[model samples]
Target: MSRKKYILIFFVIILLCLSLVSYSNTTIGRVLRFGPANANDYLEFPYHEISTTSTYFKFGEANLENIVKSRFYDVTYGNNQKVGDLDQFLEDTDTTSFIVIYKDNIIYEKYYNNYNRESIVTSFSISKSFTSALIGIAIDEGYIKSVYDPITDYLPELKKRDPRFSNIKIIDLLHMSSGVSYKEPPDDIYTYFAPDLRKLALEKTQVVEDPGNSFLYNNYNPLFLGMIIERSTGKTVSEYLEEKIWKPIGMEFDGSWSIDANDFEKMESGINCRAIDFAKFGRLYLRKGNWNGKQIISTGWSVASTAPYGPENNEYYPNIPIFKEYPGYYSLMWWGIRRDDKNYDFYAAGNHGQYIYVSPEKNLIIVRNGISYGKGMESEDMSWWPIIFYQFANQFPSE
Candidate 1:
């Protein structure tokens, strides 16, 4: 071979090596390019080290008139309805922070492990609830005609890409019944990356079941739903959020959403925000989407989103150990833990125990952010969370 040809081949190999190194240094690459090395690490991270990420949109400041601080009582919670101190329970679960709101007042708040009001934690799948709210707002604005419309109506590109996309209602995505060919194991790499989400959106997978026929907590459902919202509104979710909900509702901090190396929003599990701001979002829904007397989201939409998709008996989840006793009642990317007729708890939950829990009957809102690390912690019966939160709410007598 000529000397010139040998040098050309050498340069090509050098360029490939350089590209691989550069990709590893990218934002998403730094955090996730190498991927999770263990199940616990994949599901949760220590509180102080939770802020690493890729691209994001910064929210502007909306000062809160009140940042009331309150002391927590000796709240009882955990397996077998065990009674214990709230602080101890929090420590065992590796809680980063916990906030309790009652009757529009901050009743109990605490930050642990160097986490404070200003410290932001990753929302994980709790962001799905935010995506769901955006959908409700879009529906009210007539950006999209109806939630029941087939998703292909908004994103024509998805038509005929795969048979699975056909006849899939927007509501099915909201209700996790699109049968979108997904499984959410704790160590699933798709849960933590943006590229994987986009790739899944376009993959041609076989249609395993009819849409609206069952429940499956697939990330693609919310990811595609967010895409539909962007298409209909001509805005990223963050831009629309600031205009419609964040500023009007009075969020005090500039929360952010994780974006991929390619700069697309993760859309499902990538939201990051101060713990207090998380409560405010819950408060908006608690007041039936009315903030400061403005109906930012329709009351009907809020009610329906929080309410169960159908009869409590019909809901079913994948046969996973963590969800051994899954609620039969799933709602629009939210869970209505139908403990009973009157005291059902509506909540937005994330992996490793992040939650925004709202119980309308008690006029209560609870936010628990955590690393939530331990052996088999992912499979723990988290339904106990609302039961204990209700117990905390009942500490104060009603009028």
Candidate 2:
């Protein structure tokens, strides 16, 4: 063969090899980006170092079939008319998981093309609500003196350096009203995953406004709360939640949280869990913090965390905008909605479509998990689903 022909053939082979490698890496990164693609690769962390033993509650052995048959209600809307196709909705939004639990029973559970029930999907900011639940449980057990206590009480490191943080109450963290000037945008994902998230958060010492006066949904609020939990209990947030909440609930599988470079769990958006286990939490709140005859958390605290408490007279923080046409409010960590005269719903919603909707009146709980890639609060399509769920809630016969 001529020298020129040989050179051309060798160049073509090299290009083909480069393309194959690039495609493989891209595919792998996408798979590992969200839920667990393989069971063997699952990571486990400690759950007992964060809270008291009494705070945890174990589930009793019950018939799954019986629970589903008795507790579930067929929910349909618009005279059984089709508002939209479920397949089309999922495709348009790039949803990986969808779970609907009604009255403690699994109603509709599904996993998308690249996901499964065993996949430990990321909860995004839904982890914030879980972190808030831990704080509530800590309060109920006396580990936390009170939400009114200044964060400096637990995290003394901030006492002298940051006076604003010293006066900021723990409750303020729950409402995202700590007055920290950290704007959480979708492009700022690196801040949470950085080597030192606390240092990154604390770098912005200039408070734009006084704490408790205005509402700002900054990620620093939850990050600060996680630090408080750590300093108070001498354990990481993951360890605290595991000991206090996860194992006690008889979670079918183990869950995990992504740790920062300093090994601290990113309390703001580091939690990962199965859809069913997430439903267990919704069920816990539905039963008013009592599970299997054990008072895991104070019903009063649960009610307070999920209801509106800010200056806006709505359930959630007043600063955050509600979905278009949705009567949404921000509470301690929950989101509330005055759906209609007959329906009232509140939920723990995270970025990227992670939600746990609790309806006490109808004894219904709906869990939706998806991989939504977008900016803060703008990632998920909030409308239509809540409306559908509200309509479904009305399907049950009036008491």
Candidate 3:
């Protein structure tokens, strides 16, 4: 009976028939596989079937772009169980693209299911706010100095493959507090088509806790700040986001930015613009980083990236909706919450119910992409989306 144990039981029945046809999540097997219960079926699949299983960067010529429309209005509010009716929360959160930009037109736009306006989706960690706005334009062009250096001083291969991320700073991985050791299960095969999310962040991440004391949602802290912005700006990260913010903030199209199987750059959720180039990066941080006037980025790094650093400015309470009542903070990569008259709001959140919601003192801008299914929640826990965009940005008039 031994012909080399019958060829090792016929290669364990060919590895159990390739793990029973490799992918599942019902509904006719999620157009055939990709975990996390259909990974929010990612805007209903098709970016060339996740670009033939991932490896990206595009960001090509938007060629002096910007030409948006749809200044449609009429957002009269009323009911309140955390604000409702934006077409019943865009048909209960399968929203494809919703936009609203106040002080510069397009005050309400829509496009769903069959998705439109040149549909380029998949910006899951909202590209960690575009790799923390390219490390705040690589620390305002000095090419990485501040943010208290030491991300192994520009990835010295993370001090030879993770030496407790060798003193991990760069504002503690832009405040998500790089304790590294990755974990975001509910099926985290969600690393933008992870056949290899940068070799599991350089072989299964480490330093179990101790990078500027805590706040762990570490997507390898912008995949090590996109290898310190491509080793301090030689280029790549779609050529420094198309030469510092997509051809000088006129982005109208041609965007992409996902990569893993070796070409690295999936910096904590690869980008894929559109939806008015994510509302022109929420109107370049709602005007603070100027665009048309060209100051680009550096209204003091967009007010130190949506202000309120570390623990709600040290009072504590954050970890992305952890235990709720968010007086939030976790800066430089954006996401601050505050407001009870204290005023503060900033966002760029992604993964199903993708958003860019910025509302600098009411000079609003809200862009929301979609494909939110069960597990990767947020349509703000099923259609409350930041209290219906802060009650529709307090129904206008902050002229």
Alpha-carbon local distance difference test for all models: 0.68, 0.65, 0.65
Cα RMSDs of all predictions?
A: 8.0, 7.2, 19.6
lDDT of 3 by residue, 228-275 (tens): 787788876777787777777666566766555456666766667677
* RMSD from true fold, candidate 3: 19.6
**Which regions of candidate 3 fall more than 4 Å away from where they truly are?**
1-15, 20-95, 104-106, 109-111, 114-125, 130-150, 153-157, 161-199, 203-221, 226-267, 270-284, 287-298, 303-399
2 or 3, greater by TM-score: 2
Best by TM-score: 1
Q: Candidate 3: deviation at residue 288, Å? A: 2.8
Candidate 3 accuracy as lDDT: 0.65
Model 1 ranges off by over 4 Å: 1-83, 184-187, 194-196, 204-206, 311-328, 373-383, 394-399
Model 1 reaches what TM-score against the true structure? 0.78
In model 1, where is the ten-residue run with the lowest total lDDT? Answer: 44-53
Off by over 4 Å in 2: 1-82, 184-187, 312-325, 339-343, 373-384
Number of the top candidate by lDDT?
1
Model 2 C-alpha lDDT per residue in residues 1-399, reported as the tens digit of each score: 999999999999988876665444232232334323222222432122222233433333333433333332343332353434555445555566766655455656667758887787767777788888889887876778999998888866676776767778898888877776664453144344345667756554445666777666677778777877887777778887877777676566677877664677776676777777788888878877777788777889877877644374343334333533556667787777765565467887766567788777777777777766312214233434555566656555543
